[model samples]
Target: MSSKLFLGHRLRRLRRDHQMSQTDMATSLAISPSYLNHLERNQRPVTATLLLKLAEHYDVDVRAFAAGGGTRTGPDELAEIFSDHLLADLGVPRYELAELAHNSPSVADAVARLYAALKEAGRNPSLASNDDARSVVTPENWVRDYIQQHRNHYPELEEAAETLGGALSDPLSMQEPMRKRLKNAWGITTRVVSQSELGNISQQFDAERQLFLISSQLRPENRTFALAYQLALVEFAGVIDRMVAEAGAPDEGIRQLLHMSLANYAAGAIMMPYGRFLQACEEMRYSIDRLCGEFGANVEQVAHRLTTLSRPGARGVPFFMLRVDPAGNISKRYAGDQFPFSRFGGTCPRWNLHAAFQAAGQVVTQLIETPDGHRYFTVARTIERPIKSDLSGGLLAIGLGCDIVFAHKLHCAEAYDLADAPVTPVGPACSICPRLDCGYRATPPAGRMLAVDRNAKSISPYPFLP
Candidate 1:
């Protein structure tokens, strides 16, 4: 068909989708049926004035309102959402939008909320809408959807952890038997001391001493974690290496660290068998303290393990766990699901992970919303890392957060009044968030132009009609 005919046909399709007849649309546009029909049939073309009115009346992009001169294209929901009057109207930058989509939905959600906030603030001057500030859904997006897609549990680690338990003839002893086994198996020894004397050696193998120094700072849970790491190094190390190799981390520093973390987790599981731990966790009603007590582990270790339940068949509760510093820097992130975390930089200021510090040690529960309308439950608490020497350094204060699905399986969430308790709000950094009205926003929403109103006030920080 001719370009005019194609455009006319597309226009007709859009109008029909909206269930508007030619006469109805003509009446709305203050035009005669004959004229509207001519436009629809490609007998007459749309004028600049008509295009502007169509945009204003239909609340759609004039270009979108127009018919295509060329053939159809691929699925472009992102592109269509871009055409959104709210985004283009705000003058959010294109590169920013592209980055947000590519980076993660958490960032995109943040950007969307920030943009909405800006628009709302400009339209209505009230902080009441500040409630919108907390709608960040990035963490959950990363944890539940993205990370969960990958298997968290490694069978090789599980088998190795269990097998090592057999050789440790004296299971009750913390040091000698475990140490002897290490030396015999991998030329590594296990050492334990007071938390103060633990020093920088959390778990280090000295080839010279043939000793593996494990700080007493390690609680049973941490000891288990350290034990697991050591076991992986000794017994399952090859298997763990194979696992990472299969995962193909591409030989980078961070990837190497991640590989080591995975190895540590596998070894740790050997120290605390998965089936035993899962049963213990369930029997304990997912109580971190009780689990720690029964398994001789630490809270962090338990919480960390909770996230690794992604084994194909024999899985424990899958949880997304993150450790963030007081500064809101995500220090450690493990996705039991697909919740997106920025591959780089700090989380949005609005997230509750930062708020966990205020209530230190107390469990804080939250319900978060994303721009695309994905919702999730989050539970957060502050944890103190054990410190050793005065000269050496102090323990770092960090916050831990887990996705709500696992929270639902936990004892703390069941006891807490989540129904009435205020949920924490969050978003990705302003650079990634699409939110426009964020007073805390460091920059404008991507693709939106900053509109400064002189005469009349806009509800958002920057209001530009697309």
Candidate 2:
């Protein structure tokens, strides 16, 4: 049998948002006021019949109750906050932390803000020289936040790329045009160099020689991208600098990283002009492989470009992209759909993104449902980085997903039953997953006490106390 649902806080919030008193809500749902009060207090579990009635009468999504939709803070963030050394002495349980986040989000936000301030203060270089006092904030985190805040879309860069693309006779085949433009516009000569000459760097510009060198190990498409990226740096330097200034980068390193990201964005835009790409997406139903073939780009490049189609007037489906190495370390992430990515640890092991590593160089698709009951259609594939020698450089798995509401518009979804497909349950991370009976859980969830029964063993390795 299914567990009873206790969404008292969510129901109460909904009632208040609708400006309805307990009696009014009870009357609308055809229930007694006393019964409604009991439900509001969580004394009585929500019944399936009442849930349907509430949805039917109030015109609210049923998921709002199933997932505690009003909760703004994720369970992982709460676990991290409560696990801090400052709060460790309190010994609060994970369930209680989850309750606080769901029932009183404002309090959770205040706590998080205070913790951030404490961390910031601890990072002050003048305050201390100890390693513990060192700042946790890095250029990666700052750049990630900046990109997330912008929803991974830059219209100014898109417009610049569109203009540049229009000037070219063939945008897909960008090698010749990029080379000519680099030489004519900037007096720079482009050349393909051996791996021994390039070393660790994929592309390098020698300012004194006015020469742009690319690693010969890179595929033709990647070499083209390198050239286009260099062109973007030279031509769109002012635009990229303005964007970095607006982001308020912490230091020169972060500013340079942001400039590189903007230059990459410009390169993608140049390869696939925004207007043409959006039309092609609609026509092809967002087929990655076909798009790659059509645009003369690689699978990873095509997937990354899809996430940047958030232009105001011509928006495509909003996607969340994640790239992880074999060790499950997140190397690149961009959230366009507010997808919760664990900040404390690796993503859930059950996600197909990890499974895709087993079948390298192949596309894998899965329908996934998070603990919050939000469903997504995920596509995962392994991408190999260019290597100069026989020694393999690195291989990473890229996952691109969107909310299930857009499943019908995707070619991958054609093989599945959109309405009744079986979804694999996953979470942000094992540290915050609330699924008590999950056999694949690697660690006990935060705030829960493990019940070690010497006499009777359960299927779950770390069964928690009820």
Candidate 3:
């Protein structure tokens, strides 16, 4: 950790969110307006005592002000973004990028958004048909950014889902009650149908017949989740639509995707009611398997639920989750902190998430140290989800992890001795990784000189000049 924490942007946002002016906020904190200004401008580092004061006064979690201070994007990400040849020649200093992200996260986020648009278009050049070049944000990427902006915690959805969950107790056994509610309340009928009937779709709701057809191929957990999702759509359609309207999604496709995601979030919340699930997580010491049995959810579903425990005052240990296919494409990501994520490529190959594919259905754990020296405890496993009829046999790996500081709270971490754990050296990706001696170097490091010595075969394929 650095001696000074530059969390001016976060503090400023907090103050603005409270509708408090600098002078007012300073007076409340027993600090001068000038000092508060200095703090907001990154002129002075935030102190531990001040962070405690913020928490005490605002009733918020103090962990957001720790380590990198929970910035929207860290310098690591900025560095990775600028490493591309298209932007590398711009000669943006590393500290400037950090200052940009720390002092003005919105602008930093704009940079990231544009980068996303470019990467998405680059990935599918023939499909890029948007003439309005100002913005080409992909549907999934845009919704993902929106979710991250809100910290993946939708208060309205949470409250509504919690209320519904209380009304419908025992999430695992709510299928019948939900079916009844759908039929009685919404005048809709739900029935499981064969794969041939539903075709490629997992679930389909036909409006004309007012019938909901769920694929019989789904597992027990998935079936319950599918029903819960349909119930969420019926129950929270207004709220979900209003959220989409407020989002100002670029197109209808994006709007629909966001709608699906919010409904999915609501369904997850319904299944794992916030208060009870948090209690269970603490009581069980964050055991994935135990929680799976307790909630009747699959590993991937349980892990995804773990990442959304980000309610303001009653927050759980901050955990990041990701889903990756066998081809190393990261399809989903959530939570942000010291963890190094590749902007668009596969994250560090050294991470054990990729290794879990070999040992399907088993949990794999690793103590990983990022290039920037942030230690994390990772829990990864190969998850098998019900696939479309056409694509029947593709396995995805789900990785769930948190900072090493919170590792002790997880039951899975009990096997490792934190004091002397064997740590894996991981980087953001091969394109921007600083390591020059890794035997598994897939590509040369960006923005570094490579040493070409054909006569002497080095251990690393792409040896670089230090």
Candidate 4:
């Protein structure tokens, strides 16, 4: 191993010696657990902010965390390439990068590798490599900005959504008030147009005419959500600005995009107020129909809301939410708990996500077992996205599923046998996932060397035992 890799290993060892979990360390530093894992594995470069946080949290001197202090060598350039991209794209002078190498070699190595990968892949491609991306944010400098800036908070929208409560249950009854709010806030009229008039099922804003068109298909819930999304852009522009400002980007455009995406989350939360939504989720037992009726939100909207409750201190059940098309392409994912996820490919085939498609609209349940014997209860069901039929847009069937631990208090527990009943084995995805026997596997795990014992072969291409 290289000096950089050695340094990361030593850092990880030190962290473990302190008896701290990755999540504990990440929470303390206000960084993602995945990023910490990357840094420990020498996959990500360390940053000044992170180094300072570690020093304050662990009460260690700067060199103590680097190679010269009690450690040997760090990783090679390749290892650093795997960290995050933003540090690589810092646009800092080479001398500064070299200075960091001398003082914070672990971080410098990571940033160098990140820049190497970025240069190799050109500037735009995100899936340039398979192993480095995180679930919530793409592996880019802009994503880092999104996270580091706000510490991932949406206080303003949270406050606004709290104030806008109760306008959802009877959208028609509240339409006048909602429309007035939209007009007053955005200077646009919220007009309910026929589905035929809507060129696209989307809620479009005609900036020139100052009119916002809502599809006729929109029920009280859809209308409320659309109105909130609009109001979020206008009423909460400052909040958005603050988020962008705090992101402290290496690039301006990426910073703006991250700002808009997060603003969308704020809008969604506003439509489904966090406190009420959490209460409704527990009360309704997460039944799509029941919760939808009680909260005036759709199934997809409810699932999406469940993923965004990652508010610090007052977090809801941390969930890993994913939506997959019939082809198994993971179009959307949110890692509320930082559970291991694949950025390059699809999820485990044995997961109930694929099975959910077999019976449209019917919820499917499964107990999934990872190779390490970790078990999770999964609930999956297919839902449509609601689009225009003119071939302009049409709803696609996507499966929505969440991890099991959070399902403990859910009423759906009775639906599955959580006992020692054998769980269907699964892997993260084809590339890094270890289940080679899966007919659905598209690739094999890296560095795996299979030895054939002519007479004894397990069902999988790779043996289950050593």
On TM-score, the stronger of 3 and 4 is 3
lDDT of 3 by residue, 32-81 (tens): 99999999898998998899899889875776665554455667778878
The number of the candidate with the highest lDDT is 3
Regions of candidate 4 where Cα sits further than 4 Å from its true position:
1-153, 166-175, 184-186, 194-201, 217-220, 249-253, 390-403, 435-440, 452-458, 461-466
**Residue 336 lDDT (model 3):** 43
lDDT of 3 at 43: 93
lDDT (CA) per prediction: 0.57, 0.79, 0.84, 0.60
Tens-digit lDDT string for candidate 2 (1-466): 9978777777888798689999999999999999988887778889989988887886655653575532545455777777655675688777898778766766875565456546655666454444542243555766765675566779899999988966763745878998999999999999998888978777899999999999888888898789889999998989998888887776688788888888998998888888888898999999998898778788878888898887644778878899898988888887555565575457888888998989998889999888778899999999887444566657889999999988899998899997888899888767667787888888776667888799998877888875
The model with the greater TM-score, 1 or 3, is 3
lDDT of 4 at 459: 61
Kindly report which residue stretches of model 1 are placed more than 4 angstroms away from their true locations once superposed.
Answer: 1-151, 165-177, 183-188, 192-201, 215-224, 244-259, 390-407, 415-425, 436-439, 454-466
TM-scores for every candidate against the unseen true structure: 0.60, 0.76, 0.94, 0.66
Q: Could you give candidate 4's per-residue lDDT for residues 1-466 as a string of tens digits?
A: 4333224555576577679998987888898899888877667777767777767776655543453333211222222233233343433444454345444655654454345445545544655665644222334433532342232336566776667654443543435665787777668887878887866556788889999998877656667678777777777778778867865544556676676677667667766777777777777776667867665667777777766664433556655567777777666665444344443346777677877777888777777777656667666877766543455333334443445656566666666656755578887655445565665555434444555578986565554222
lDDT order, best first, reads 3, 2, 4, 1
lDDT of 3: 0.84
